[model samples]
Target: MTLTSIPIALTIAGSDSGGGAGIQADLRTFAFHRVHGASAITCVTAQNTLGVSRVDALPSAAVAAQIQAVVQDIGVQAAKTGMLLNQEIIATVSEQVAACKIVNLVVDPVMVSRTGAQLIDDSAIAVLRSHLIPQAAILTPNRYEAQLLSGLEILTLEDMQAASEKIFELGAKSVLVKGGGMSGELRGVDVWFDGNACETLTTQVVNTPHTHGTGCTLSAAIAANLALGKDLRSAVHLAKSYVTTALKYSLAIGKGQGPVGHFFPLLLSDS
Candidate 1:
C-alpha cells in the first residue's frame, strides 16, 4: 500500500525524567530522522545527569495498555524497547509485540548501566532471554550486557564476535555487541553478527564525557532508519554515523554527564 506522511517508530521503555535517556532520547532520535515517534513508558525514574535518585515502575497491565493504545490506532512501522525493568514488564511487552506482529523490533537489553553496574537481577535477565529477546529483529547490547546475556566476558574483539554469535543463537535475527565500555584499543568498536556472517562496524570515535544516552540514541536511530526502508546493515551503519555526529556535539547540561545533541545540525545552525 502507498502512504503519504512520514514513517512511524515506537519505543517501549522507561521514562527518563532527566530527558537524557530512555523514552526521551528515543523520541528525540526519531524526530531527528523525521519519523513519528510513539512510546509506552514502563517505568519512571527520578534522575538527572548526576544519577538516578529513585525509580517507580508502572504495572504490567498499564504498560501493555499503552502499547495497545499506540498499535491499535497509530500503527508503527518499526519499534524498539529499552529498560523493561522486570520480568512482568518483559512478558507483557513480548505479548504485545506478538499480538501487534511487530517485525522490525530492536531490543536494547538495558540490563546493565553505563557505569558497569547490573541494573536487573538474574531472574529478570532470564525472563528477557526466554521471552522478549527471541522476538527481536535486532538485539543491541553493550559489553557488560553482552556478557550477561551470552554468558561470556567480552574483553577482546574475538570475544565480542563470539558473544554476538552466542546471542544470535538465542533467536534474535541479528546481534550487535557494543564495545563502548571496553578499555584501551577495543573501546568504541562494535561487532555485528547475523547467522551467516560477522562484521565489524566502526566510526570515528568522538572523545566526549557528555555521553549520557548514547546507546538509546543509536538504537532509536536504527529503528527510524528501518521505518524509512533501510536494510538492517545499512540501518545499523547509518545509526552509528548519526550517533558519532551527535557525540561531536554532545550537550553540557546539568552538572554531570550530559546528553548527545539529537538536533546537532539544527543547534549548530541556530548558534
Candidate 2:
C-alpha cells in the first residue's frame, strides 16, 4: 500500500501523569486515526483513576512557545484545546492559534466535571468564553459546562437543543452539548448546532464505570478526523462512533475509574 505523508493534529491541553486523559488521551486518539500528534501542554496533574491530587500549570510563555514550535515546523492541520488552566494560558493559546491561523480548532470546554464540580475559576471561564471559545470551529461542552456557557439549565433534550443554540451565539462556528453527564434516555446522546441546523447524535450506550478520558478522547478524535480531511459533521459522527466503541472495551485499571480503551482494536486482535 502506497501511503501519503501523515497528517498532523495538535493538542493544546494539560498532562495527566496516570496516562488516562489530557494530552495522553489526545495523542492516543490521534494515533488511532493514523494522524501524527503534536502537543502544547498547559498544565500537569498528578492523578490516577481515583482523582487528582496535585496540579501545576506551566507558564503561559512556555505554552505559547510550544505551540509556536509545533506550528512553525510540523504544521498542524487541526487542533483541540483541553484543560487550559487559567486566563493567561487561555489568552496566550487564543493569540497563538490566531497567529498560527489554525482554522480547524476544537474547543472542549473542560470547566466542570461529570459530578457538577467546577474545575476552573469564574474569571478563567470568562476569558475562555470571551476569547478562546469565539475562535473555535467547534465547541464541545458537557452538561454542566453547557449550562454555564448557555446560562440555562439543561434538563431535557429540548433544553440541550436550546443550550446548543444559545452557546452558538457566543461566536463558535458550531456547538456540541455532550450528554455524557445526563441521565435516563438522554445519556450518551449529543446535541449539535451549527447556526443552520440542530441535530441530536446518538450511539449505543456502553454501560461502564470506567469512562475516564472520554471527553478528551472525543474532542481529540474529532480533531484527528478533521486533520484527515473530513468535513465537520462527518468528523463528529465518526468521532462519536470511535468513542462509543472504545467505551465498550474500557479498561478496568487502577483502583477507581479507568480510561476507555483507546487502542481497542489492538486489544481485540491480541485476544
Candidate 3:
C-alpha cells in the first residue's frame, strides 16, 4: 500500500508509566483501529492505577521539536492532544499544530483526573482556551472540564447542552461535553454540538471502577476514525461505541482504577 493509503494518526500528550493512559492509551487505541500512531510526549508521569506519584514536564522546545519531527517526515492525518500540563507546553503545541496545519485535530482538554481532582491550574486553562481550542476540529472535555471551560455548572442534560454550546462558542469547530462522570441518568451520555446541530451520544453505563484512561481512549479513537476518513459525527459515534465496549472488558489490575481494555476484541477472539 502507498503512504497515502495507510491511515496515520498522531497524539501530542504526556506519558503514563502505568501504560493505561496518555500516550500509551492513545497509541493502543490507534493500533486497535489499524491506524499508524505517532506521539510527542509533553510530560512523563510516574503514575499507576492507584494515583499519580510525580510528573516531569519536558521543555517547550523539546515538545515542539517532536511534533516538527513527526509532521515533517511520517506526516499526520489526524491528531489529538492530552495532558498538556501547563501554559508553555499548550501554547507551543498549539503553535506547532497550526504550523503543521493539521485539520483533523481532536483536543481532549485533560484538565481533570478521573477522580474529579483538578490536574491543571486556571492559567493553563486560559492558555488552552486562547491558543488550542480554536484550532480544534473537535474538543472533547469531560464534565468537570466542560464546567471549567464553559463557566457553567453541569447538573442536568440541559446543563450539558449549555456547556457544549458555551465551549463551541470558544471557537472549536465542534465540541463534545462528556457526561460519563455525571450522576444519575446523565452518566454515560455525551453532548455534541457543532454550532448548527446539537446531538446527544450515549452508551450503556458499564458500572466498574476500572475506568482509567477513558477520556484519553475516547478522543484517540475519534482521531483514529478521522484518520480513516470518517466524518466528525460518525467518528464520535464509532469512538463512543469503541470506548463503551472497551469499558465492558475493563481490566482490574494494580489494585485501583485500571484501564479500559483497548484490545478487547482481540482478547475475545482468542478466548
Q: Pick by lDDT: which candidate is best?
A: 2
Question: In model 3, which residue pairs have backbone atoms overlapping below 3 Å?
Answer: none
Give me the candidate number with maximum TM-score. Answer: 2
Query: Each prediction's TM-score against the native?
Result: 0.97, 0.98, 0.97
- Model 1, 178-270: lDDT tens digits are 988988887789999989989998888789999999999999999999999999999999999999999999999999999999999898898
Residue 76, candidate 2: C-alpha displacement in angstroms: 0.7
- Per-residue lDDT for 38-149 in model 2, tens only? 9999999999999999999999999999999999997999999999989999999999999999979999999999889999999999999998999999999999999999
- How far residue 141's Cα lies from its native spot in candidate 1, in Å, is 0.5
Assess candidate 1 and give its TM-score to the true structure. Answer: 0.97
Cα error, residue 238 of model 2, in Å, equals: 0.1
The positional error of residue 226 in candidate 3, measured at the CA in angstroms, is: 0.4
lDDT of each: 0.93, 0.96, 0.93
